[model samples]
Target: MKRIAVLGMPNTGKSTFFNRFTGATASVGNWAGMTVDLMMATLKIGEVTADVIDLPGIYDLRGFSEDEMVVQRFLESTPLHLIIIILNTVQIDRQLSLALQIKRLQIPAILLLNMADEAPKFGVKVNAEKIAQHLEMPVISMSAKYGNQYGKGYDAAIDAIAQTLHQQEHPICVRNISDCAIDDRQLATELDAILQDAVHISTQHSNTLTTRLDRFLLHPILGLPLFFAAMYLMFQVVYTLGTPLQAFLSFGLDWIKVAALEPVFTPFPSFLKGFLIGGLYDGIGTVVAFIPVILLFFFCMAIVEDSGYLARSAFLMDAFMERLGLDGRSFVMSLMGFGCNVPAIMGTRVMRSPGLRMLSMLVIPFSLCSARLNVFIFMTTALFTPQVAPGVLFSLYLFSFAAALVTALLFKGQFPNHDPLVLELPPYRFPTIKQIFVRAWVEVKHFLRWSNQFIIAGVVIIWLLNHLPMDVPPASKQTLSGMIGQAVQPLLQPLGINSQLAIALIFGFVAKEVVLGGLAVIYGASNDAGLGGAIAHQIDWVQAYSFMLFTLLYIPCLSTIAVLKRESKSAKFATLAVVWSIALAWITSFLFYQGARLLGF
Candidate 1:
């Protein structure tokens, strides 16, 4: 198989082009920093399968940025037949610079004028022939956003790959490096000259549709409120609409447990039944049932993201984010962390600087991941009034953002000179069904893939610990899990958390959703009563709030810790994070509990 490396500057629809060619659901965002990792897949053009690699987006081949380093390292290691460069036709003048730099390298390549449909809206026209003639390479104008045109574009793109591969010895005429420094102003001027005669931009004296929408959505008076409202609606969807579907799924899983699996377990030994049915099956079931809520969230997020509203969101937030010494683009990662922290952590790869990525890693945990959301939903519904549940949930989210800001502020000096937000907001494109479903599916799969193993292992471990000491009552003080929880109970006294809650926290360290499952086991509450109802018997509203606060602030799950360890590649850093979060969780919750008591709550 031949090889083609897809390279481009950020927000040029490179990932979209790759996705179209390979049918891989690499994330397609309207802003920069979306594709942070190397994506490789097989692209079949007719009968030939070519190995296609989508490299990290780069502004120049200067090897200064983290993503540039990623591209540099990969290129040095891999042998390639053709270099496919994706360019945003709407940003042709700025986008052509990278192409010019690559052309100087004398590599066999083709320039894909991606997102061509947006060219007209931007009042820009690309003369592909002129670009090709001057650059001495094939140039094809295409739009990945338009599904109808996507097929033709993709087909032509694949054919271009084939053509480039065939011309292996016949390299595109290389431009001389001469006295020009790679990223110098002279080089940029020269690159601009290559397109001066090829491209024309008409004056947009009046406002366009996007400009019209921005008037209301990004209006100074309404933007912040609108942003908060969008966030509120996000949480509301998970709780309001997701609840009935979650209940239905939970009911199905429970039926399978009792009506199907329990009978099969009746003849088995007690230990085996507990291990299989109670430990493995029930544990996996508890987490899997929440898949609906996770899916719903990603679906909503994808719509907002692909619609280009997220960029405006970042624009509105840039001022505040700069105050915290972080880029507003990191806000995207923060919001993503709400769905799942692993990818959110991974998403930090798009940050160009080490300081910014580190800052994002430290801050993302405060974003209230979906795993934590399960516990939040259960506990909030259990203890708070329905009239106030949404508000309570929203407050938790608000607190998360607050915590992240505080975290960023405290650590800002360590990461001095963090990258400023220079996001380019793409035009609002009504997301095709393909775009929405594909993006949502990618996130859902990522959640499941990252979570399933941890869920199963964590569940089984809890079951073993809770069931040990053969004749002892389940989750009693004498049991292994109970003894551990008891040992730590003294530390939690000020915050009013009991042994069961303590044990749940200890295991919740494994996975946050397990807090509910562990509660069900410790409280000996049947699935019929609900984890929330089961827990409502044990703790009052004040204790519940303290409990929720602790859960929110505590150490992230083992999986997150593992990823942090790997990403930061610093054992000490990861250890410090664990210790700091525990201390923070304890102190914050203690303060909330004590302060509330003082106020007569």
Candidate 2:
């Protein structure tokens, strides 16, 4: 199969195009490096089958960020059959520098003018045929988010590649230079000529809603408040408005237990019934109960992203970021970390400075990702009533931001100097309803795919741990996990997390959700009603609060650690993040416990 690599600067809709062509929802965002790692998919254009690889979004090849290095290595080793350089029509001048470098390789390529629809609205027009004549290659104008108008253009590029692969001479070269050396000024002049011929200004409008909103959203005084309010509403909706949906799902699960399982298992022994219904069903059911909240959270994020608010959020955070020895552009990755940290860490390549990039990667783990939020809400609402749950949940998010800020400050003191933040502010437009639904469904599907395998395995593991005994009664403080918990209890005693909870926290290092899984095993096995009922009967509100605090601040899951190791390129940094996070978690949990006790809570 022919190999075609899709290259572009960040936020140019490369991922959206990849998703459209491959039918793969590889996390499309309004920010750069969303596809941090290389993504491959097969696209069949009539008689030709081609392999399309999506490379990391980069600004210039001259820089040496991790994502840029990935692209560099691919260029050096792989014999790319064709290169599709996607350009945002609004930012054509800036994006063409990379195109100039790609052309120097003497490889067949096509200039894909993505987001063509937005160009006209931004008072810019590009003549595709004129651009093709100037560049001496095909130039296709396309809106990848909407249609297949450029299908023929993509085919033409492939045919050009096939025809030129073995040719003795190529059309592209540093023109009028026999020495085979190109100068920066000459490259700029050539680019300006191309833009002059291909690009035209139609008309410009003033006082757009985007500009008026930015006046407040980007203002130093009002920006932070608006940001907090926006996030507050997002969390509140997930918890408050999603409650009925969550409860309805839980009610249905309960009905299945009573109406379907009860009658069929009437003759079974009580232990067997408890094993299947209470241990198995209750353990998995609790985690599943939060699906509605998860979906709602993704839906809300999609709206914010689609509405083009995230870019403005990044712009607002840039100034504050400079104080921390990193650029504000890092906030884009940190914000994306809310949905998933893997891509967010990868997105750090957009920072341009290696020092700032590493610093951003270090703190990304501190972001309260959606996965951890699941554990947070489940434990918080179960321990405290729903009326006070939003406040408690909000506090956890605040704590996470605080942790990130403190870490950034500490890192800043150590490093001392870094690059200033430079970012592009794209013109905002109202996102289509169809686009929002598509993005939401894609995220929901991604969540289900990951949760189904790992969480199911987690449920079964907890069942074994809870069921297996070492000559100790189920309710005895001398049971297997209890003994293990006691052995480590002293270390966490200062933090007010008891032996059992500490043991659960240790298991959580493997995966944050496993803390709840561990709790299910310990509490579910002891009581017939399951983990929720057992916790309600045994643990007081203060201990529950301590548990939530520890869960929020403790070590991230193994997957996040692996991504950190890869992004930071130093085992020491990754280990430091893990150790410091745990220590911080212990300190915070301890303070909350003692303070709550002193306040007579």
Candidate 3:
């Protein structure tokens, strides 16, 4: 199969272009740093099956950012049949320099001017044929975002690929060092000539929508407060809409357990039946019930991200972030961490400096990931009134940021970053319903995949621990789980975490989503008394708050640790993350629990 690579500067709509053919919704955020790693998918161009690799966005071939290194390494190591370099039509004058650099490599290539529909509005005009003639390569002007569907651009792109493949020359096997070593000044002069011949921008045209929006959204005094209010409102919508659906799903799942599965297990022995129903059904079902909530949160986040406000938020936070020895890009990684920390850790590759990347790795794991969101939502609803539950959840999110800030402050001296922030603010666009749904479904599928990989196994293990020895009452002090939990209970006692909760925490090391499953198994939550009821009966609001705090501050899941080890390339650094998080969690929860107790809570 032929190999093609799609490359571009950030926010060029490259991922959306890739998705047009693959039918896979790889993250399509209207921001820089979204594509931190290479994404590969199969492409078919008229009976030709080729592998298409979407590379991380980079500004310059010689740039020192880890993402630039990624692109450099791929080109140096991997042979390629073609390179599809995309440039935003509005930014073509500046982006064409990257095209010139790639041209010097002597690789077979095509140039795609994405977002062509918005060019005229920005008072930009691109002469594709002129560019093609000047560069001796095919240049196509098309909107990747809108042209892929019901538009001629999609068909034109496919046909262009098919023809190019049929007429292709030898594949690129090695770097053309002499050609690539051309003087930068010469390349700049050539780039300017090409732009003068093929591109035009009217001085009268400006993106009024972006200008007006940024005036308010990026204001120094009001920007931060507005961002916070928007986030709080988003959380409110997710909870208010998702909670009822979650309850309905939970009820339906319980009905299945009692009405369907119970009859199937009736012929088995009592112990076997208990394992099937309580260990497997109840435990897994409890976690599954929250799928609606997860989907809602992802959906809301997708709209915010695709509408292009996420990048603005990063810019607004840059000043505060720089004071902590980081920058706006690191803040972007932290916000993305709210979805999942493993990818966020990998996303740190966007940092140009090693010190900044390490600092970001230390801070991102503290973001309140969706898994922890599941746990906090469950606890707050069970322990607090509806009127106060949103406040409790919001407070947890605040604590997540607080924890991240403190982590940065504590570790900044060891790892210092002097890299200045350079970020692009894309024009705001209303996200299409199709894009919103696709993005949300993609994330939901990810949650389900993680659940299958970790939560089921965690539930089974927790059940075995509680039911082993075949003599003691389930979850009793003599059982394996109880004994294990008791061993660590002493240390957790000050934080109001009991033996059962201790065991849950141990299981949660596998994945935070499994914490809910472990709790359901430990408590033997049934249709009559659901997990919420069991939890409410087991712990008061204070103990529940303490557990939530610990969960928020402790080491992230094992997958995250593995990514940290791989990305940081240091077992010692990964180990330090674990140790520091545990210490911080213990101390913070201890102080809160002690203070609350003293206040007569």
Cα lDDT tens digits, model 1, 450-517, are 66756666677778788888788777778998788878888998898887788888888887877766
Stretches of model 3 off by over 4 angstroms after superposition:
25-37, 148-151, 176-179, 525-528
Range of the 10 consecutive residues with the lowest summed lDDT in candidate 1: 27-36
Misplaced by over 4 Å in model 1 are 25-37, 166-186, 205-207, 349-354, 520-529, 565-569
Which one wins by lDDT: 1 or 3?
3
Q: Residue-pair clashes per candidate, as listed?
A: 0, 1, 0
Better of 1 and 3 by TM-score: 3
C-alpha lDDT of residue 514 in model 3: 86
Between prediction 1 and prediction 2, which has the larger lDDT?
Answer: 1
lDDT of every predicted structure (CA atoms)? 0.77, 0.73, 0.85
| Model 3 Cα shift for residue 450 (angstroms) | 3.0
lDDT of 3: 0.85
Tens digits of per-residue lDDT for model 2, 176-241: 222334458888998889877777765564427668878878888989899889988888898997
Stretch of 10 with least lDDT, candidate 3: 27-36
Model 1 residue 149 CA deviation (Å) reads 4.0
- At residue 273, candidate 1 shows an lDDT of 84
Q: Rank the candidates by lDDT, best first.
A: 3, 1, 2
1 or 2: which has the higher TM-score?
Answer: 1
List the candidate 2 regions with Cα displacement exceeding 4 Å: 25-36, 148-183, 202-207, 257-281, 451-453
